[model samples]
Target: MKQAESVSDFYKRLPSHAPTAVPLDNAGIGHINVFSRETCSVVSPYSRRDFYKVSLIIGTGRIYYADKWIEIDRPALLFSNPFVPYSWEAESAEQSGWYCLFTEEFVQHSERMHNLRDSPLFRIGSNPIFFPDQVQLGELSAIFQKMQAEMASSYPHKYDVLRSYLHLIIHEAMRSNPAEHFAAYSNASSRVSALFLELLERQFPIDSPQVNLKLKTPTDYAGALSVHVNHLNRSVKEITGKTTSAHIAARIVSEAKALLQHTDWNISDIAYSLGFEYASYFTLFFKKHSGISPTQLRGVV
Candidate 1:
């Protein structure tokens, strides 16, 4: 298997030209194109890029992501976040399906769309896989069909129609699978976790272009959170089942993969972009977690 790049790698590759500005071709931003097996099979696990994809399965297949294989059957609703590398393995070569490609901006402009974040099921980090019931399947199919009709229409406000239609399906999916509530926790624990996640995200786009520099250590984050390092560690461990440092490292690693796969930059450029002073240090850090060297992952696709 080829090595996988990190989440940050994709961000670096955000298309220079604003993603195609062409008007809806019978379908708006939420356009659903029925793909052939030959087209679908081209999506490889080693390649990395951002694309909002939803597949309505007509037959059984296996999807590989985040180091796990999820079996997808008929009436299945599978959503993959942009930048997450996924590949399909199906028993039969004659599988068929309607595939939709969209952008995050299309759905994120509304108030109701906030549920996309509250519900971890749709997010990239948390794997949200759903096997819908027959009734639910019919309901979702109707929504897809409605979108197709509106997109094909020449209404002056067709974009709005397309956006609303997409939002309806997203909201319905969120309602079908309610977000899991965490156990009641004291204010301190909750505050600590929230702060940690924020701090972790900020460490990205680091200053160096040759290697990723260690920004905000555990103590650094603890200091910013205004808590003792031990207390911060305890709170993170109790709430997330992982240490503060570990969480930070994971996000950093994910970002590194994103930059590597999506951008045209050389290893040194990528290393420096992530805040590393020396490319070797970043390589060492990545290999420790990903089990492969930076150079080996360049042509992963």
Candidate 2:
């Protein structure tokens, strides 16, 4: 899987995009910023985003939602959460609108996080695109305009004000509707978890008995992702609701079952290929998770 685009990468990838703020603040807590899509460029990656985004598109474009597509020829509100993969393309030469990008910590400590995440607009498998009429577009536009104002303001609590504006925008998306693991690091935990998962899954499906599992432990994943084992454990559990060890073991067990059923490879070879030095160890692990020994499951499965 492709690494999700980070905030910095967002700017870098969209060459035509310019920072709406003078100082160009993509740092600090929450790190929310708004910009106009005056001269838009297509971000055709069609992959996950590292942070959350809410876009008010006033131009014609095609949106790449998870496993689907939405063509926007009217003013539309798109609520993009971190989990789902998405992208957009400007079909017309001229594009106009506003969008805001914010990190997980921006709302992590507040109840609004749940509201935003649980709302239909941002929830996975829900419609993320909404077309609001002229009136609703005005209301949404004003909020974004206000965001630009506040972002350019000298007010001490400008961020607090921006947070409210974000909430207002999210609320309107519904009519209703919209990490961790930091501010400076920009969702270090999630990025680490994603990288770890990528590394783990990359070694999968065991093509041959001669090939050995390269990454078979939490420590291996942690080292590959350049995070501490404890950090990896906490981050994986926090995001996936499963510990690192559990994830590794589950993958191993799954591969073992496939090997036992699909191929005639010896149990010892299967064990060695899955990073278990002893066939007995693999059998014990398989039984623990699958409730049956590898031998018993071989023909039965």
Candidate 3:
């Protein structure tokens, strides 16, 4: 039930005197920070983060991604985006990895950034975990090392150089396995389905109490997407094998579970934030989907 960890929270969790030299900008162009696992504190178990993370891991571990648990046995390259909830548990005590955290705005300066959504790194359903051979690992490690060095440097345009390194790392991972890259959709159904999923995911994490979900039903999403409700439902069903309403209900339940478990907010506040007209109605909807009341789920958690 934990909320997503924000960028400021990330820095606060780090040890004092840990490298903290990131550019502060007003344009929402985010800063980048690189760290070796050995030098940083362990992230809390099952906690979610609100930024993008790319890591060159050198030891075995398991990453809980969304509903899937992926085991990593070899040197691996892992990418985590903001939408998916993930946590890492290292299997080896002697774990070592170089990870760089960046925001969506950090990479917007490059043309390749436009294709980021289609890349396995940011794609919702694609596998973000990959095993790399020694050569690939070494190459990736070198990129991280360069990024770390650049971060500590006093050069005026160091960020520009760092952005280039980031692009290099992204391109290297994409090239590592051509077969894993997501292909462009050639059909309208696939395109619509992908867009629908994207739109749905963008409303997630429910990070703040002041923020409320605006799209709650199939008709709402269809209207936003400029499509008939039936057409939207058909496309989502064709691609995902689930009805649009089912998907919406499932997502709402997931968020409800998170809010119940992670926050101190009362049932009424939670229900209102999720677009429920009344707390009783929210309880009924939650119980219908989860087989338990929200309060019960919170107690179990």
Instruction: Give the winner by TM-score.
Output: 3
Model 1 regions lying over 4 Å from their true place: 1-51, 60-69, 73-75, 83-91, 114-119, 179-186, 198-216, 220-231, 249-301
Cα lDDT for residue 57, candidate 3: 81
Candidate 2 per-residue lDDT over residues 1-301, each given as its tens digit: 2456787787788755646553334344556778887855655665678788888998898996653578898999888887766668788877899988888877764566645665556655467888888888999999999998998888988877888888887666665322111123348777777667757756755666888899878988888877889999999898889899988887788667656765678999999999989989988888999898888887675
**Count of backbone clashes, every candidate in sequence:** 25, 2, 1
Clashing pairs in 2: 116-178, 174-177
lDDT of 2: 0.76
How many angstroms is residue 21 displaced in model 3 relative to the true structure, after the best TM-score fit?
4.9
For TM-score, candidate 1 versus 3, the one ahead is 3
What ordering of candidates by lDDT runs from best to worst? 3, 2, 1
2 or 3, which is superior by TM-score? 3
Q: All models: lDDT?
A: 0.61, 0.76, 0.79
lDDT of 3 by residue, 1-301 (tens): 3567777777767646244456434256676888887754344455567778898888777887665578889888888887777778877777787998887777776676755655776787678887877887888889999998988888978878888898888888888767647477868888888888778877876766666899999999999999999899999898889998898888888888877875788898889888898999999999999999998987887
Q: What local lDDT does model 1 show for residue 212? A: 47
lDDT of 3: 0.79
Which number leads on lDDT? 3
Model 3: weakest 10-residue lDDT segment is 17-26
